[model samples]
Target: MNINDIPNKSFKTVYKGIDEMEVREYLKEIKQHIEELEKEKESLQKIIDEKNENLNNFKSVETSISEAIMVAQKAGEETKRSAEKESERIINQARLHSETMINDAMMKSQHIAMQTEEIKKQSKVFRARYKKLIEAQLDLLSTNDWEELLEYDKDINVEAQSKVDNIVNNDDNVNN
Candidate 1:
């Protein structure tokens, strides 16, 4: 029977009533049973202690895991912040560069416009000068100098005839 069944025990009495020796023997057995229960209680307490230790270890591991998760989250937030700052810096740099390029292009456009205006002014001056030169040429060609030119041509014709006469006279002499 179970050790817990000791409390419900009932002993049968002898004819003269309960035997003193049997009572003593029953007391001895009950004492041994109490000792055995004490040993079992100690053993159960040791098992309980071991289980408590394991539970504490589990709690510690859980705490460590929680701390690790927190650290990782903090690191991720820090990385995100760094990336955002870097992106902002890059966007600002690109904006500045684009503005510089636009300004440079505007300056070049203004310079080109000024140069074009100067070229137009130069073209007008050249056309004016060329027009005056052509008009002077046209005026000279339309002049009344043709009479003087005809007289000069007559003098050239007379000189050429005289040379021809001299050549004929020399040939006649040579033949004689």
Candidate 2:
């Protein structure tokens, strides 16, 4: 039998034989106590195991959450970088377009200025030629040719008046 099933018979018997019934009863009660303790131990061990499992699950969930946060942060950083790059590209393209427009405007301005200069030179030459033509006409009109023509017309009128006077005189003599 197990040690708990037996009674403690350490002392010697005194005259009558030792009563085993009381000892058996006591040993039985002690065995029952030991069995109760074992059951309590098992119950406590199960609770501890359950609690440990819960703690492990909690740790796993915490790790997963941490990893998720890291991934989200990385994605956010990538988005920010991509946006910055795209903005820079757009700005550079705008700058190039504006520069091209400015360059075109400058070239057109230079062409217009050159055209204006050429027009000015052409106008200057035209004015000089026109002035020279007007001066030549004035010189032609100022010559003695117009005066001689006027004198010739006066002489013709005087000769016609004298012929009329002679005719009138001859008529008067015929009438007398």
Candidate 3:
């Protein structure tokens, strides 16, 4: 029977049977022992319940940490990919910019070269014209006309001076 039935157990009275008072006393002791054991069991159960709750808490923390780590890893990978793309884009942009700069520089250099060639041609034309003008002046100086003018009478002829001025002016106009 269960511990609760211990006190209610009955025994038939007979000649020289066991003492009732002694039996009652022994039953009382047994009941007290059972009560103490139940109290101890209850205390142990409470400790077990607390330990289970703590274990569950630890498990939940572990799960949360794991999730956080996963999220962090994903974020790191995404950031790395984005950075690589950005760097590649920057490099491409720089390449295009450099190419454009080089092309512009080449075009400018070609224009400058053409300008220099034109200047050289103009300089050659100026030199040739200057040479012809100088030759004409030398030919005029070597003519006998100047000697005739020098031999003329000391009293200068106004008409002859006017003719000389007209000839000089005509030469200047032709040279220009």
C-alpha local distance difference test of each model: 0.90, 0.89, 0.92
Task: Spell out the clash pairs found in candidate 2.
Answer: none
- Name model 1 segments beyond 4 Å from true: 1-17, 20-43, 153-176
Task: Give me the runs in candidate 3 sitting further than 4 Å from their true place.
Answer: 7-34, 148-176
Which candidate comes out best when scored by lDDT? Answer: 3
Q: Between candidates 2 and 3, which one is better according to TM-score?
A: 3
TM-scores of the models, in the given order?
A: 0.65, 0.58, 0.65
**Candidate 1 residue-wise lDDT, 50-152, digit = tens:** 9999999999999999999999999999999999999999999999999999999999999999999999999999999999999999998888787678888
RMSD of 3: 10.3
Show how many residue pairs clash in every candidate, following the order shown: 0, 0, 0
Across 1-64, the per-residue lDDT of candidate 2 in tens digits comes to 5655346534466788768677678777887888898889999999999999999999999999
lDDT of 3 by residue, 5-85 (tens): 888777898999999888978998998899899999999999999999999999999999999999999999999999999
Superposed model 2: Cα runs more than 4 Å off: 1-43, 144-176
Question: What's model 2's overall lDDT?
Answer: 0.89
